[model samples]
Target chain A: MVLVAIILSACAPGTPDEDSWRVDALRSIGDVSSSVSSVQLALQHHDRLFGPYLQTVAVQAEDAAGTASTKLSAVQPPEPYQGRSDTVTSALDDAESLLTDARIAVVRRDSAAYADLVRRLKRTGDRLSRIEDRIRALPDDRSRP
Target chain B: MKKLLNVALGVLTAIGGFVDIGDLVTNAQVGARFGLSLAWVTLLGVVGIIVFAEMSGRIAAVSGRATFDLVRERLGPAMGMANLLGSMGVTLLTYVAEIGGVALAFQLICGVDYLLLFPFVGALVWLVLWRAKFSVIENLFGLLGLALIVFVVALLKLGPDWSQLGHSAVSFQPPKPEAWSTWAYYAVALFGAAMTPYEVFFFSSGGVEEKWGVKDIGVMRTNVLLGFPLGGVLSVAIAACTYVVFNPLSASVDTLGQVGLPVAIALGKIGLAIALLGFVAATFGAACETGLSTGYSIAQYFGWQWGKFVRTDVAARFHLVLLLSTVIALGVLATGIDPVQVTEASVVFSALALPLTYFPILVVANDRDYMGEHVNGRVLNVLAMFFMVVLTVVALAAIPLMIWTRMGA
Candidate 1:
């Protein structure tokens, strides 16, 4: 029974389940979050080849974050949950804007601008992380005893 | 039956060369993003490795020489040096990645940081290289690598849509959103992982280690014909596992733990146990293989006697290269670089280094003086030469595509 439920959940596609869209939306943001941090790791390691291509990474990351935010916002939520969804979308907005700044700073090798953006990116990352935890803890539709 | 079983070297090379750490991660990453669309690259790589491994193995059997040895004799000193430098550079990079890969695999089970496990893994690799007999090393890890078969079972249990997978395999486009560059980059990485230069160096060198003669040619053919393709299947199964589990969620696999998630989901803890065993065995086995190949390439290039079969006292240069390569690998990992990144770079670099070792081997294989009657026939030569072109194109495209895709994002 447990295995079947797991399999069914895995196979379900864009169902009308209350948390379905948010779960997928939040997870996509998490993927982008993971990719962004990997880029940061590459830079932190002073990886000359991949890390230094900051403009390209920032542009790409910005586009992904922007698109993810758009998608997350497009998903209609129940009235009571609208604020939480907006909070998540707002985090993505901050990420997208900072990534844009990161691109220019990275291109100029402007340490001050890049440092400022990094600070903002960290805060936005923290909020998105909190939102992800909240969304994951949302009750599974069928899990209610 | 016994002669067929003599394919231990081939099987060992398959486990390490064909489906090592680089292949495991790259295949899963591709599958998550591209589905089985890149499956054809794995197939192409399988055929390419068989052709070259057969030639190199035949050269060792007929000429009593390994690849680097004949590379110098046929291509002369300058070209040999270039080959040595290119091949050894990638081999050493691969050595570092393989050691780090083993550490990563062990980390999956023990929860220790891979950097901390480097010393133990490196020590174990060196110990096996130093103390274990050739056949013992080959058979032990090779058979254990069969544990990766858990992937096949998990895939079947997952019951993926076979027709959908087949359709993805036939389509040439990137799944969506991802550009042609990411697809092309991974294609080259997959190709490079499949036909990694160290595999040829290790395979030919292992042939020499076992002291194969022309009579052993049949066994070599069996290994190439049978053992290698099976290894490619292991690669595909890994990709399919990811495609089934992660593709739906749009989740990309960036870590080894996630690679095994589908197996656990399908077969529970027992499956996880077996997959982890496979990971350790495959990565540990490759570490030993690559650590030795580092020695093999340098020793063979300089005309210094080298082989695990030979005493360390007699092959001091070879053993020293092994020790130095291990230390260098440990140094790189200690810098806290991601082994997964090293794994990605190693495969792409292998694509770049392919032409260096391959061109000379093709020249040597056709030389009647070296192979006697075992020379490549006209048909096989045409096929081998064609794949050489394929390898060259992959070499040229690997770096640019990696950059354009930001290392596949």
Candidate 2:
């Protein structure tokens, strides 16, 4: 019975308070941003890396971004932070989508497509960094822990 | 000259065998996040492992018994059983991680799913353990594992601001945007990866396997003292490489593929190829060691007559343990769980298991019945005592910190 309860608790959606919810969203954005940057860097070095290696990294980045997106999306934000939460999730969705496209380019060994994908990845990655900075600058609301 | 050559081989193997899957992943993760700030923990762990490894090696050489054997005899059955369970659980988890790591390394080369590669990697490791000679397993993989030195070359080639890296190495502070809890969590992980309990078990048992008598003590000390520190350097180089390429971009490293990116950027295709080879050799070699260790710990505890020096038919139960462990590891990896996550959990749990593993070695190393005149000297005793306290504290804090930091998130 105890084990079942523990498992259920773990599997249940996390309805974190506003402060902690923002923190989770921020972490998700940072993770996806980092993964996007990694894919971008790998794509830039396409000629220097083995095709399989490049494809593996791209797939890994896509998985990372996808996982981050899913995790943040699962969290139930406090009422006041719903709009902000949507913004974070939307940005994460964008990052994950871009990473999926990058993984495809890598698997297809579409070098010509990489230059364009690289541009989009950089823009998404920069947007993530900016979101991360904005979130980090938010005032602490430690009262709601 | 042959004696010198033996010492040289021992040292090189030590350096090559030092960075297993745990070290590679943890060091890279910590590096990409904190730069070299947590490097002191690795150094501390190296010294700690060196201290205990030297003790365990001496015990095996003088007593002609492995760690588990002495542990059972000296600590009594109940305590020994406790130690065995704790250490064995961690070693087995590490075995699973290493097998998964080997599969992941192959995945990078062939772009095959690591889950699809688990059985093949597990079978290959078991085949080596069953058929290969002990020295063959140790030397070939250890030498090939040297390819990881590419990380050091990559670090140098990246031409990082040495002074900045050196400052971070000494500062012991987490870079901003990271919590101290996370920093402490990775510190424990890094320490656990460095001084994994299995290294000592494998070292002492290998001593017994190699028939290290009193005469071989000098050579054993050379290997532990010289090789382990250099291996620790390879670990630091890995971290520095990630720091140079990933940290400034605020990029986190969560995959083996990201771990190799710095090398590709630094030295291009050739360097990345060598790095991949290093990953395969290191993880494969560690898989063999951890697999054998699972067998060694069980057989040593039960008095079942184990060692690679003996034929598999002669050590039937021991070989059986090895086979079962491989299957079990493969079974765990088959869950489609991420190997990197398994590696992370294993290292943290390794920290939690360290006290149970090392306390027995310390006790037996000081026992006059086991060591005779070869007992630990005054200076060595003080150092060992210090590490015992540190290991105990690390073990106590491991679970709580792991929970608090959410596996270093």
Per-model DockQ against the true two-chain complex: 0.04, 0.57
Q: Over the stretch A5-111, how does candidate 1's per-residue lDDT look in tens digits? A: 34654555453346666565556567656445433432332223222233434544565566667776677766556666666667777667767767666667665
Can you write out model 2's per-residue Cα lDDT over A79-133, one digit (the tens) per residue? Answer: 8676677778888898888888988878887899999998999999888887777
Give all TM-scores, in the order shown: 0.77, 0.97
Best by lDDT: 2
Question: Which digits, one per residue and each the tens of the lDDT, describe model 1 over residues B225-290?
Answer: 888998999899999998987777555777666677677667766777898889998888888888
Clashing pairs in 1: none
Clashing pairs in 2: none
Kindly list the per-residue Cα lDDT of model 2 for residues B102-157, writing each as its tens digit.
99999999999898899999999999999999999888999899899999999999
Model 1 spans with C-alpha error above 4 angstroms: A1-145, B7-17
DockQ of 2: 0.57
